[model samples]
Target: MTLLLSGVDSFTGIHPFLLVLAAAGLDRLVGDPRWCLHPVVVMGWWIRRLQQLSERWAGDRPWALRLAGGVITALLVGGSGGAGWLLEQWALGRGLSDLRPAGLLALWIALTSALAGRSLEQAVRSVLQALPDVAAARTALSWIVGRDTTELNQAEIVRAAAETASENAVDGLFAPLFWMLVGAGLWSVGYGGAPGPLALAWGFKAASTLDSMLGYRQGTLLWLGTAGARLDDLLVWLPCRLVALSLPLATGCGPGGCLQGLVAALRDGVPDPSPNAGVSQAAYAHAAGVQLGGLNRYGDQLKVKPLLAAGSPRPNPAAVERMLRLSLRLELLWLLAGLALGIAISAVGSVQ
Candidate 1:
């Protein structure tokens, strides 16, 4: 599906490569623009409002919570797609139905806002700069990580930052792109046709946001958030493995080293706690030359997860930067690979 969309006759009406490059530039220079109007932030606010308003009526009942969650998911995903379609139409109309400056700009904004590579890097860099002051670093890290940072040492903080950054390479970037591509082909052939990449990417974001907000194992969210969490896991499963498999080639790590690290990751990664997180974390831990997945604190509870790359040294500030670099490599590789495949698919479609 992704291949078809990415391959379709200008799936976005803009050259895929040019559109992606523009989006990347946007990510680097304006990333979520702390003060600017942000789509995700707006979605988050709406989700929160809907959930709270429903809670007033749903109370603590499992069915009510679950129902509320379902409603939230539908609203967010549907809303994003509708909004994308509307924007695309406006852009296309303004540009005389051609993918010129106006349409291209709209596409660029949608794709750019969907990515978080720069923002995530900036966040980890903050922790790195705060350094030696574990307290300051922890405070900085807390914004990015969900784990308790109050008792963490410098090493733990760096590890969390690196791990999150590496894992998010897929979440904040690839997975959404994958879906956008998948939707492209469908949009091209569907009734009335649609401008796909933007709509699909935002739809993916809706799912991810829902999982983050409601997908918890404790409290009312335990039962209510189950659907959101599972949906996120299902959508991300393949992308995680894909990223893990390519981590070596993307980072330009030698086969000998990558192979060795992959062995460590397979032995340690597949069995780790998270249903999907370990897949990416394993390759990242090995490629970044850092140890991950030891004991982590979540509030008063301490959980000891399966360790990865046990032979490597503990993560440090250097490891954080290295991991971030590796993640970038993975994102680029995925983009290029997808583009290549898309070209082939588009050719195939044309022949048919």
Candidate 2:
């Protein structure tokens, strides 16, 4: 059972790469639908339900309700990981090879939970296509980002889209993989197999949910959401930097420029209010040779934030396409790295 679990974790770790390939193929075969229901969507649905119930039960006590909601949200997130562990155990006990089609299928589902890949690209593209003339683009961008886009010009629209894409690359792509690696390492040390990749997926989803729901600078929800947001920030710290570094490596930005971009991002990105998001946005903005970060709306509220990167004039539609292409390249690089690591680990274990 132990060997099987370890083998499964090692084998299934490559699922991210395979899934990306599959999704890309799917994208090419059929055009992207504007609305795809992700696993996180289901998670969000349940979280909102819990929040509503909490509010109902503790109508007079906002603090109590917020606390209850936070606790419930954390449990759901952590429980998803435990559930994955059990599933891995069940699969191992059934004598299914870790690399079998069934195992791969499980991994694919788990990777999909990460919510890092194609959907994000499509979302940005949708806004870009609708921009400058379409009211729907303003609404769509409003949904994805906290920025105010009510009176945004074309350049501002492109900057907002680019910024959101770069930030999500950290949260959606790199963070889940970081947790997967952590879970895999722990699994190897103890039970000899990591839980299904879904464990990390659920955990990240939970964290993301909490961050979104309660991670505001003001109001009663601040303290309650602090731990989740901080933990998320810590988990993505390295991965965020890696995402930033990829900007230079993939975009032909030299090391000197990349470092400069990194420093500039670290110094300037801090002004955006999100602890970790600015780093990647700043890096990508510098690498792409465009300026990012500016004033925008969060609902009806206007947030005037400092700019992250200083570069040429505003981005046009072509620049939007370029950013997407760069993002795709970075995604591919990360997927390839994951697969290689998985293969190497499996080979080493086999020899041992």
Candidate 3:
């Protein structure tokens, strides 16, 4: 297990934890630069291209669409993961001692691109900034959420923005962080040329991208999108729960209060159809002392969600701002915790 520390040094000239921290900092400084071709945009293009091909091949047959979708999911996820592994190997081969500055920069940029904390915050804040003016707010909110915003009032706009911010805390931030750590742990155990951090992070991103684009219940997407949707749900499950448990504590709550918060979040979140979304939203709802989850419109359908933090007031602009702040604080907390764990692992490996 000497590889824990030594391999990290050789691979990136620093600890993976530090790389992640730097990447997150970079993301905050410059979110998905508008001038450049973002990786997720490329990923979305590929998904659309593949969907066209799949539709042509599968025709209208339900089983055929399902099969085609499964194949597409496998290919996209596998290809994304494989690309990450190859890029890492090519960049850091024979270790960073060789002093490949371009390679190191590339790795940092890739890592930064994978994280969406800043981007998500910016989007939500855009909606918040458009507040009180229902038309302007709806226009801004339309860009971030799937709900019909045309009929939404100011309070509903605030609730929708709050919900988007909370739920995406899992998708846009925590899940990628969790996978990168997992991959780093695996690499330290002597798994060379395996996923490692970047590969696993990109892979999770690919799955998330798939679900966001194709995972719908309407028409052909019902069957054709199942593979991507389920894969995203599976990948996000552990991270979502981790966020639910830790997010409350990050709010400066005492141990007993943290436990109560988790219990309350779970009690309310469990009833939502999504395994992860409910818990995440509920966690933030309770932490912010605001209610979330209510009627939402997706295209032509209107759906009602179970109320979380039932006795609390509906989220206002203030509550939404608090939730965003909480997200930022929680991110810092997780980064510190991950760095501590990495150090502990390295120390244990040194002893061995």
RMSD of each: 4.2, 3.8, 2.9
- Top-lDDT structure, candidate number: 3
**Which segments of model 2 are wrong by more than 4 Å?**
1-37, 57-66, 91-103, 181-191, 217-220, 253-258, 346-352
Model 2 TM-score?
0.81
Per-model TM-score on C-alpha atoms = 0.86, 0.81, 0.94
Instruction: Please estimate how well model 1 matches the true structure, expressed as its whole-model Cα lDDT.
Output: 0.73
Task: Report every candidate's CA lDDT.
Answer: 0.73, 0.64, 0.85
lDDT of 1 at 130: 95
Model 1 spans with C-alpha error above 4 angstroms: 1-14, 93-97, 183-195, 253-266, 345-352
lDDT of 2: 0.64
**TM-score for candidate 3, residues paired by index:** 0.94
Predicted candidate 3 versus true structure: per-residue lDDT over 221-336, tens digit per residue: 89899999999999999998888888877789866776777788889998999888999999999999999999998878889999999989989888998998998898898888
What count of clashes does model 2 give? 6
lDDT by residue (tens digit), candidate 2, 1-352: 4454445433333433444445334443343343655666666777677656665676646677557755765676777667666655554442334345675565545545565556677778889878666577778788778766788766677778888877886787667666665555444333335554456656776777767776675554554455666666766788777666566767866667667656766887767667788777877777667777766677677767677666566666677677778877766666566567656655676687
Q: RMSD to the native, candidate 1?
A: 4.2
